[model samples]
Target: MKAREAVSRVLPATIACLVACAKPQGGGPPRVEIRPSDCAIPSQPLLRGIHSIVAERAMSCAVLDQGQVACWGVQDLGRLGDGFEVKRRDLPTRVPGLQGVVAVTQGNDATFARMADGSVRVWGPNRGGEFGDGSPDYHIAWAPRAVAQWGTIKQIAGGIPTCAIRSDDKVVCAGRARFRRMNEDTAAPGGTPVVVPGLESAAGIAAGSGFTCALLGEGSVWCWGMADAGQLGNGGGEDQDKPVHVRSLDPAVEIDAGSDTACARLAGGGVRCWGRSFAGYGLDHPEKWLRPVEIKGTRDATQISIGDRVGCALLRDSTVACWGESSYDGQLGDGSDETRGTVAGPVACVRDAVQVSVGDNHSCALLRDGTARCWGSGTYGAVGDGTHEIRKIPVAVLDAVEPAPDAERCPPGTTFKRGKGQDDLEAVAEWCETPDGKREGMYVGRWATGQKLQQGGYVSGVRHGEWTRYYEHGEVVSKDRYEHGEPHGVWIAYSLHWRFAFASCFDHGRRVWQVSSEAEANQKRCP
Candidate 1:
């Protein structure tokens, strides 16, 4: 069965169990009857150097213990930064020889990473000089090469093309001048690196699927490139080949972009989103918010990350909330597989969430405790548990570093209260019925002992033919042949409970029935 279908079936039962357990009269959380082997707690040696991170476009990413980065996904033109022209890498491998990386950014197939020295390196498909190497050839740089034109880079952003900002405040870009095409006059003279016109002292840059935006030191925003989806936040559908001011935004500290949407976080910790509502990342309400629409109910948002189908915000309280499509897997972390168009209910897997990142079908959060947990699709081991098992809850990737031990044996007679008893007696009775009449003719005792209570072929309250009595614990308490509910023929009795009160055979409904001399049974009288 498909994972979604399987989850749908199992989730209802699981939810029922949870709801039943939460009731005041009901018991606490149901005991999970998992075997020791099923827990699979790993040894510490296997957890060394495992770094879990998120990337765009369902891409595969790897982060070294020292923070080096490499990624591969949707590389139609070698944009996956693997120094290859292949379509995609189904497996993850290290990027040849790159080190001392602090952060990474990706756009389509091209990738850029910032190093410890504040230098930036880029590779992959560079048809428009988006590789930042002053070349437009579609060649893969197998080794990390420095972008000499831009230095002291604090942050980097890439769209259809690539752009970066230096610590000194200047913005430089390399790639086709598609953003200039919005004016119709400066339609890119082929592919070349050009300084974005008008902007100086940029504090940050954000790149969408096709457009780019920059947060300036003056507390204003500017955008360029594809505007078909209003991703530029310029309140117009026309593309901007050159940088144009986005007057709608206030002084912003951080900005994020998805396939066709852009959002910014204000200094006051309020968030405003624009572009591509159809993708469900723009705003909860309809009407195509060309300008910034304040994200409802989100306050103290310190960090934000946007994906093609979802968005997540890290709050100052160290909590993370997400919204948008969660169908691909547990990407939303709302404890449901259904897609959500609005903000998700809060989740509390960790105490102090420090960093959050969203992928096409997965998400990861770094906690203040230096631990990282991930959820969503694990088809590519994106959850980083060393296994590809998909989880709907945030699972510690480092928790299971070693293989599970052998399965342990359990003693017999282990009875577990699976869940609450339904008030529907008919349903409960039907559950105790067996194919043959063997278990029928049993009476319900004062206490439930897991025994099946069933009636055999009977008329009124009288029992006839073979009649059996069961121990409340599901064991046979006695077996007797009866005529009209009165014991007849051979009768046997057992003990453990009720001490086998009586064992006798009777004619009709009364008279001295043949009685067993068993110590416990003969000591009591029959009713």
Candidate 2:
């Protein structure tokens, strides 16, 4: 249940159906007094890859070593598809015509790609069918189709009734109507793609939030639609349209799920999990296991992520371990948000690791030299590290391919120098370009020994007037006022001995109240 709680209020996944879905980005990323009215929408920020990470919910898309794919968080209903929909995009854009690409998934609203000729595409705002193509829409598709004849596919799983695994392994699914009942003798065709009844050879698939699982090549795993928390481990909570065989677990090579929990990866590597949501594996509250358990010291592992609030594993020495619910938001990257003790520890700064995903409260890892690291909640920037702040441990993913190389190149932003300056203290960062780059004026950021940390006044890229944030040693951690990017006047935020930690007032960018003293934000105003 710790997917960062904060649904504030609900009713949307196209009329919610009461629960099988309805959780779109709802309010969970601003602390200190917590005025939250329930924001909803659920996600943001992620970049992976020596090659992979397509985390969904609020948004984040990756897959590049050259196979291009970019995306940032919450781009309104177009969800950062990159065809310009505006509302949010803290950076990372590309997603135009796509190319060679090999994977990506984002479900609950669309964004699926799996090409390299095998073909499969799908774009945003797809109502419930989430582009499984069963014909659900509310406008906003904008572009991105290809889901035709079905064959050559290979593997795809974008939760809530979205599956694909062909090339003869057979397994087709599309959106939901509870997956068209698979078959009890043909009553099909209501939403679209069907065939699951006998789940032919499958071999791999994972989708959650409305159920769907598969692994069989004899390793056995089969699951199907919403079991109300037991996450269909087969022990049962009751909601099935067909497939149900998790009992006693089996050969399993690797598997995953979140939003009701699920984990697997034992052929000897060991690491089991079952749903209804995490709560320390030795168990205390989230009951519903029904079967799959394992998790003690978690063995050799080799990958498993399950996040809606922590459940990592990637061992075999690559290192990574996680338990559950870190007090409130750390999602257990470990640096400190405290809360562990059912055995899986170490996740503090990350290392050799090769891949890990977990999203819905943040977690990302993908290092083996190709670099990537992310920690809990960075909101619309989802910890991609360009800064939206909040990271507890694990940072460093400055656009992963841009912004580093000594910095200096601000088309949209980035500029840091090493030499050639009015006393180049070795820390020179400045942004605010124009001359066709669109932005103009000033945006400083320093720290490589120079220490300015943040300055303000950006133009076309928005952020107007005074802003300041520092702490590399110069103290003063935040004193805001923006007009272009909204949030006008007095925003505060500081606490490392300097005090205040909250003080807000804003105007153009909204916020009308927030206090922790600037004398309680100057006695309060806005009414």
Candidate 3:
């Protein structure tokens, strides 16, 4: 099953877990639509010095060299962990209040940040007890919160129900227990994290929408959860409520699970996959495999990732080869969108690729240079570019480093012009104003879709008057005053629903006061 289809199937249960919450925010840029395509920037790089990369349904995040976490794409339900108020960012924004983050992963709309200290922090939609916070309430976790008192976590994987590997090599899971993947016939109250019975000394674990798999210390593999798609690889179509060993597969090193399929890297550098065989197990004809089957045309595969329908392998030569459902969104990254094929080939412009991650419609590759690139579906910023446009080839994920000299060059109304300090990363050589070469006036920028995306007054390339950010749907998301490029006076952030989320006062560049969803307090403070 495709990840999108899996999401829709699980949506009802997710929505049932949600609860209302207060809002919070402050004004900054023009509002983009909260929709999949509206909130992205155009052709931007998102992260730098990336040590690891993780991809979810339509979002991607990375862990930097120093354990800092950055994520972009699909900020709904606070999945990005930047904050709840941010709809989406095409470029990666560092997840706040975290350090020493060794790894990251995601469920449908949630993120798990694993710290070096062996503790885990989780955020985003808490539906079906995926947050593992021992709470039954459904809500968006605007920030990373501790997963109750659990700690000593070594590895973590996210899914409809997230799972983790503790220091003792025991596996623990939290989330919906419908498939009994949690190993207990009856789920613990409040989705508390619990040990998977009789499972220990595991080397790695992978979580899927409704299943989990583990690579044991002895190089054996075990799986549980819904096996209707043959994902369990136990030579049967029946579901297993507890971990069951698969015959004829041992010495496995790594494993990954998709919506309805799973893949493993063997001790000999080959990859084998089973489940929803239409996705391809290296055969000319799409057929389901009840047991592990080697993916043809692949060898020396150091790493592998499975998308909803597509799959990719990172060969030892640092190139990527993708197959299955390649046309769904250029997920194959071969420059053309072919509907579906069993033939795996090299991805365009992907070299020195150390790690690869595949999402529902897109995929990303982390290079040895510590930079990241993505291709395929960009709708929802899945490609990590700043726009909703689809990419036919790899594009750099905007990094925090200095942008290219031309990056600041704005279009028409906000065109970039030569100016002093133009080379400085903080310099805004571009200004927003009348298009007739006018220097002193307000400027407006509009999208090709014909909606105004930005409007603010400027003087000599510097903002110097009232600025308001609007949502792509025409609702105002923020209002603030600026004095010569610096924020001043009242700053307000509005939720996508047009509700007051946060209010703040800025003097020059420093904040005077801030309140979370307390519009009255902000009004009085600003007044």
Computed on alpha carbons, the lDDT of every model, listed in order, comes to 0.51, 0.56, 0.61
User: Compared with the true structure, what per-residue lDDT tens digits does model 2 show for residues 408-458?
Assistant: 323335332222111221122233334443322222221111122224211
Collision count of model 3: 11
Clashes of each: 13, 19, 11
For candidate 2, give the lDDT of residue 371: 46
Say what the RMSD of model 1 is: 24.4
TM-score versus the correct structure, for each prediction: 0.60, 0.31, 0.69
Q: What are the root-mean-square deviations of the candidates from the true structure over C-alphas?
A: 24.4, 20.1, 15.9
lDDT of 1 by residue, 167-267 (tens): 76777666664455433444334344456767878887777666778889867888887788777777888977777777656778777777777778888
Candidate scoring better on TM-score of 1 and 2: 1
Candidate 2 CA-lDDT value: 0.56
